[model samples]
Target: MASYKRHLNKDYTVMPNHHLRNKDLSLKAKGLLSMMLGLPDDWDYSINGLVAISREGRTAVENALKELREAGYVVIRKLYPNQTDSGIIEYEYNIYEFPQDEKVACQDIVYQEAHNQGTCFQTIENHQQLNTYKSNTYNKRNIKEIQFDLTGKEETDKCPDKSTPEIELEIDIYTYNVQIHDEFEELWKLYPNKKGKTNAFKSYERECKKKKNPAKFEEVKKGLIAYCEYIKATNTEIRFVKNGSTWFNQRCWEDDYTIQNGKNNQTNKKAQPEYELL
Candidate 1:
């Protein structure tokens, strides 16, 4: 008996430096060409398959392939089988082959053969056909153009006939929403207790709804400032303060807060002298 060992050779594809450095070709075209070269010689040449494998948009892949074909970096050949006894012709597509040099030598031969046989080569014609098919199938509409007056006059004065009820309504809504958020932000900043900001905002919104008046926000603002002062004068620790949401919910601003001296242990009110009844 004889022992046999199988040996495997590493397979790789080579790309010319000129093709990689070609300034005439787009970046997408160069990338696609390099990827095509790396594929096996017998790999499938379907455009849809290439698009899926490359993870690129179909239109982008198609355009890149067109660019490569136009640059003479790739050559496509069409094959036709011999007519059967029934006089029917069968057409087969051939995969494109990448050129080995900057000056592609095989293009003329392929073009001449295809022209003689009255067969089509995958090139600009295919791209045009694909675009035509898409346009017809989707029936996309052209973008409408807006004509503007070149004069320096304001738009309102120029186009007085164009009523803008819908536009005005949209603007009003946007302005109102912005004003509400601005007011809330001012209140949040003035609050002494910073925790539970999201909940605090929700509580503020709820208060706004209950009051149904924009002026209420101003009142809340004043209360926040007073509360911050009270916290400082009393020497209250931040941890001991109520969360913003709880303070807002309880309407703490209405409650009267007196400043007391913690260091001297003195009450906010002045102490009266203790005198015997005279």
Candidate 2:
């Protein structure tokens, strides 16, 4: 996908490109803002409405909104039941073209009329409805996700960046407590030693960053395969096998390990990986 937007069609509306270029906003946040800009004026701007169509869950949307609001692209206002502000009716989200300073939302004529009448916005009809939305929550496979609209469909919690490669995509789940590369998972499956996977992955990621190249996944994979073979050929016991973390931490992939009558090991800086992953 194009990293930059181009206005090639008349059917589209234009928006500031700063959101795309903003160093502070994440990829998910940028996509969400672009989506909001594409929405029609009469469309539902409720949190639930936003959540329904998103591949991300409520938490992702909430965090993105918080970032946008702080950057001035979004303004959230609490609507009250009456002029006295005794009861909250609902929140009104005002999307802006530019970052706005902290101030009361500028209302349109229709909004003014509704507020002066001390009535809820057209979406929110009464106090009971407001309480219903606020009180309801659902257990989403162990994660407590707040349900703002009973009518909204479930969200998948996937990253919004469709342009990313599959390897990168797997690493960017952002939530649901998953943060390992597909290549590393493969390595884990092939390794003879199976301890401290969490630490191993952390070390794996750190090692990758040192190379700053994910394309070398094959190198790591081949290294693991060779190491596992060395263990089998040497008849190394499980208790004496090197931990996965130790393999990465010591950069053992460079070691020219061998079985000398099923007993000797060697090391060299120029040693190449042996054995294919499959």
Candidate 3:
């Protein structure tokens, strides 16, 4: 069934959709994650708290949380009672729009804990008896971060690289051909060149989030297929093919595609003649 036309003009939160598109997350988990992320940071985040706002029963909500946790979208920081820890003091739930590995997630937790430090973290001294250097808030806050370095050595203070660059093609996502939404991976698979997927997905998300005229996912699919065929039909080498990120950034699909006889165009080998787009 077709969706009712959406008018995305007001009262919207622009958030990343990596988790929404994640194949590992169940539909219920995805919906739950999306809803939780939409809440303000000061939300009373808990199992029952989410159940109060959602139609899902307690069991379903619990299951969704489990899925989110297993998928790395929901990270739980448990503060043990003491050195001989018996119970948790408080549970800190860290939610992410995108899944992250253990290493990055550990660092991410440090960043979060540091933001609310002194209240939650204590300066545990290491064997070297070296003074713990104060860290200014990595996200530009003036507050110092509580250092938890285990090496008895100072860690270099630096902000995490979280910026996803945006390319301003400024083209309407709607093309002449009408279509439905599909996964970004399909476009990745269809694209001949495979480099810069992280940025390629970012560009894909940019087009998908076009204010009122977001991209038709099928247009991306058709465009990728057409582009692939053009490359093959023209005997273009892989080296001559554009990177996935560059292709998306340039809005290459909007360009009129041309193709010629591979044999006849030996002299103008770099140029494409014309291929009728589907």
Candidate 4:
């Protein structure tokens, strides 16, 4: 069996003097060319084939091929007539190679130019082929990759791991059954007549000012009211959280000890004594 050899050609379209100038070829184009030269001619490749090997999509492969063709290094024979599969076109490529003399001459001219610029090089031909090509001819070494398009694939929220545990939320509650009259009387006693009323209005105004974010305040207010209803139904304990930035008392409730003590104090002494005896 004949061993496959990737052929490099002299028909490169790059200006003869610029052939060895690495910047003359784009990284992707250089890579594609190198790959084409190294791979056996018997092996077939397409734009998609380059996309798969380069892990870059069709556009990248196309750009590389375009660059190679423009440089006159690679010739392509399109294998298929334009045909669409579900609205997408398909195509294949057959690349050609050229003589070696022109390849060496191209490399030589580039090396001499560089050598004149104070860049020292013992000899161009002696330089490692791949390294010399990469260092002198190609601008981009690393291939830019894009994710494969999976527009038509079905997806599910299935977890790969079965052992990951689920978590549950802890729900707590609090209740405040305040008597407005009693609180008003207490305020009157503390501030005295009109002064008490004035102070109360000022405090309310200040609180409203503190609750500057009306949206957040409204949200908290609704949540607090729901929380109050929960306490009324379930009688669970809840602590009020105040918005520090806004001086808004979003919600308030006594501690568990205070609640229990208050409940006990609200009960009749005789009833308490009877319950204790029981």
Which number leads on TM-score? 3
Candidate 3 deviant stretches above 4 angstroms = 1-4, 80-88, 104-278
Clashes of each: 0, 0, 5, 13
Q: Which residue pairs of candidate 3 clash?
A: 258-273, 258-274, 259-273, 259-274, 260-273
Q: What is the C-alpha lDDT of each candidate?
A: 0.50, 0.53, 0.51, 0.32
Q: Any runs in candidate 4 off by more than 4 Å, and if so which?
A: 1-22, 77-278
TM-score of 3: 0.35
TM-score of every candidate: 0.33, 0.34, 0.35, 0.24
The residue-by-residue lDDT of candidate 2 on 149-256, one tens digit each, is 211354333434332111121222222122236667877888887877777776776665442333257787777777888877877798887677766665677677
**Model 4 lDDT tens row, 15-115:** 22233355778777766676755553334343344566767765556566556655655432211123322121111122334323445424322211111
Model 2 sits at a Cα RMSD from the real structure of: 21.3
Quick one: ranking by TM-score, best first?
3, 2, 1, 4
Candidate 3: count the clashes: 5
Report the poorest 10 consecutive residues by lDDT, candidate 2: 128-137
